[model samples]
Target: MKQARISTGTQDLPMRWWSDAKTPGAMIGGIVSNAFAAIGSNRQRSILTMLGIGIGVAAFIAIVTLSQGATDSFTSKLGFLAQTITVSRARNATNTSLTLSDRDVKILSQLQHVVAVSPTISDEAEVVFGKKHWSTTLSGVSFSYLQMQNVSIGSGAWWSSEEEQSRRHVVVLGTKVVENIFGQTGIDPIGQTVRIGAQLYHVIGVIEPDSLLGNDGIYVPYTAVYTPSKPNQIAQISIQVDGTDNLDTVQTEIQMRLGQLHHIATDGSGGFDVTEAIGQLKQTQQQLGMLSGFMSSIAVISLIVGGIGIMNIMLVSVTERTREIGLRSALGAPPSAIAVQFLLEALALSIISGGLGLGLGLLMGYGLSSLLNVSFIVNTSSFLIAFGVSTAIGVGFGLYPALRASRLDPIIALRSF
Candidate 1:
């Protein structure tokens, strides 16, 4: 008898593309390698397709980080404003004689939690230094004014209390005044004599650049600006509190005390208005928050557009690999494997793109901070959110195309050119 031959039929052998002895790790390694290989095969198309996601991620990260940096800078730099209060005569006040005075200053100083008080008298005059004459505002204040406004003397010392009491004609020039009067001559402004109207005043100091209260005016003793006829009348009073915690209480006490001093009702009939700096700060922060939200919404729209781009490219990829998919199916690859391969390819693209975008965003945010003269800050949440969103977009947008590819009939797919 002839030797018995073993039949190799479909029913006799299992049609498994992967080996039964292969570990799950090996399967995962193979899938990942194949995904990278497919992406590498078309480098130019992959990079171009990645642009949409890259741009979206970059804009999102940059905007958020930059906004946060700016807000922090603002709060730190101007935070002192929150611990201060401003008292000004209301514009609607009919009594021109109801002016702030030394009495008001004394009362404000003695109030609970009050740290400092400085009265200001504002006027305008033509300042003449040699042939240079520039018209500017004049602020008449005491030595305590500089400390209260967080202003530092850039060049020379502030006038002494005796100089203020004697009503001496000494002036502290702001940066703008120096630029205009002494800029062309390159002259040292300190100890220089400048004429205000018909009177001459010595410049004792120069205000530092970017001073909150001294950028565009000249400062002198309040007694120098106020009429000798009206001894202690002042234009406004600036009050500093010990800390933020006492701001509301101090403001209320100030209003009540001033109302009593002026012999006016405490309601709305008072001649003066009290403005809490913290309120203005909160309003500004709210505006910034709103602006950040609007920009974030735009960034989200960009991400959605990028997701759509991902889906479009994935559908194109599936179509291009029709014959390959059919061949793999015919070779006993399961539909699940086909889906996983495509999905992995999409995920890989997004991961790479997100990384590139994150780097670009950091650079952009740093440049922005430098441009705005603020601090550069990196937020960890931004990185995590960016990467997480990118991965989600890949999976979400790539799923349909992957399923469609897996469902393609091998006979029909193979017929495609």
Candidate 2:
């Protein structure tokens, strides 16, 4: 007896999938297995395609992580300068004889937005402690210098105001200075006597190693360092403003005041220079941000190239499996099943690529952070976005090829070479 012929129409396609499965889960499993089998057939091409994605991801992650780490480090190291200004002898002044003095400090302190003023007298001196001697910077500062500079005392207390006022021979040592003199002898630095130049000064405190201003110097009363002939001579004056908004105003006021005091014109003829640290910090950060953006743009181009490669490869795959697709369609597989199989292959390729890219990116970030001496940070949002973008690329790029494969006429496909 002759059986009735089955219709291979679009309406009849959804009745079953790639296999004779009785349940939805089992049907899905069979489709997935077939998709992976197709991918496994061309192992070399698959890996090469994924390489583009991996490189793009690694570059993106490393650049962003390094950018953030550098910004954080700079902010921490120089954040204090945002509210401070410094006055020094102008290096480009026509009159090189001009110098700073205590008068500048008092005048700056009386300004409207001024919060604090501390003067510094810096010089290099041979420091001798017991059998060891080292030449380091000797900074003469006021009693308020430590607090103004945000310096922390490591082991001993900062000198008293009275001690500074009386011109006592007491000093605060930097961590480097202590290390050079005391070595690893386990000696208590406080109360130890160290000679600076020819004067014997007792160590009253040790500055924390991370102190920005006093990292490699010694601090003493400004009066103790003063020569009898130049009693008011000072190197620079550091002024703290009440807020960041008033930094420019205070800086201008200081320049005008210094010009008037020195009997010089205010038009770049003044003997002093005024610098806003915040301006320098902003400029540096802006340059860094631009560089990071440029690098990220290149990474984005890499991703686009990788996506194109995926589309090209998937199209080639569809062509290579034309006979198989026709056979499946003739054996009762639907266009939806054929489409799903191709789509799944693309997704599997991309998902695997993304996973590999993630690991490679982290390693690259870590190595870069170490080489650059910055912190290594893993941002969760960035990670999620990377993964999501990869998945989307898979679906978007693979859609056309999948559809073309599904829509093929089984009779035509079967007759083709």
- Model number with the top lDDT: 1
In the range 67-104, model 2's lDDT, one tens digit per residue, is 88888877877777799898888777788667787666
Can you list the residue pairs that collide in candidate 2? none
Q: Choose the strongest candidate by TM-score.
A: 1
List the candidate 2 regions with Cα displacement exceeding 4 Å.
Answer: 1-33, 40-48, 228-233, 266-269, 294-316, 328-340, 359-377, 395-412
Error of 1 at 278 (Å): 0.5
Give per-model TM-scores.
0.89, 0.79
Whole-model lDDT, model 1: 0.83
Assess the local accuracy of residue 131 in candidate 2 as a C-alpha lDDT between 0 and 100.
86
Q: After superposition, how far is residue 96 of candidate 2 from its true place, in Å?
A: 3.2
lDDT (tens digit, per residue) of candidate 1 on 291-361: 98899889878888888887888898898778777766776778998899889988898889989988998
